[model samples]
Target: MLPLTLRFSLLALSCMLPLAALAETPLSTERVTELETLLYQDCGSCHGMTLRGGLGPALPESRMNAYSRDGLAALILDGVKGTAMPGWDGLLTEQEARWIADHLQNDNPLDE
Candidate 1:
């Protein structure tokens, strides 16, 4: 019923729709500041203010880099089972979690 070109266009749009949905909006400067504080204070409550490890394991850049960005973001949002690590889904957006993951992997204090 549809022209070949029309069908091809529809298929292309369908493929791109999922990607568009997955695209995250940019975070604001103030939101970034808040996220940084949360990462250092709230998450820091367990990972340590300096991220040197406390009740939770240390979050060195090396270790952070070991995880894929999306994987780490999922972990941040979902929390580990049978552990003290609680999910942040209630308090954070997926974009925020990814931002935190990026910071831990790239801008973390513990370079080693």
Candidate 2:
């Protein structure tokens, strides 16, 4: 019963709905950069500039094997008590915590 023009317009609108929803989601570039800077400044101070062994233990594959991305994010947000690590829940958002964990998970000191 719809006109051809109305049907075509509905089809186009339906096709664009998903993209419009996606566009509403904010990009996390600021959060990602904040995490990167935090790692380079705070963590790097103890873990070494390159994340190799330093005052803190090495963040090598073997050492990092026990941590999942979620686990690592949790650790960052709620630092290990009785240890040198300090919780960053107030300073970083959950997304930033996750970004740091993801970055650490992929870090390879051996890579040139």
Candidate 3:
């Protein structure tokens, strides 16, 4: 049988694992600002700087609200097939992607 101390340590670790999995690194103020810029500038390059539609369709708030937050994050990370949209997974964490998705859905500038 394991020693009492070892058993206690294992129990503590098991309890903490779930909490760790649930915890995402919160975005800093600077990171949020950077993401906003990326959304308008980088994504805007195709979607339009104002998201009024350029090479891509306009990202009206009504349309943005149609997608689930997680679904939108996945789309941002994975990009659409055969489309100009490129996956940003290489440059962003899942948390960051979620933030961008939430921003687009909740705080989008275009109020169509």
Give the whole-model CA lDDT for all candidates, comma-separated.
0.96, 0.76, 0.93
Write one digit per residue (lDDT tens) for candidate 1, span 1-112: 9999999999999999999998877999999999999999999999999999999999999999999999999999999989999999999998899999999999989999
TM-score of each: 0.82, 0.66, 0.83
lDDT of 3 by residue, 28-74 (tens): 99999999999999999999999999999899889988999999999
Q: Clashes in model 3: which pairs?
A: none
Residue 52 in candidate 2, Cα distance off native in Å: 1.3
Sequence-dependent TM-score of model 3: 0.83
| Higher-scoring candidate on TM-score, 1 or 3 | 3
Report the number of the highest-lDDT candidate. Answer: 1
RMSD of each: 2.1, 4.9, 2.4
- Residue pairs clashing in model 1 are none
Per-candidate clash tally: 0, 0, 0
Clash number for model 2?
0
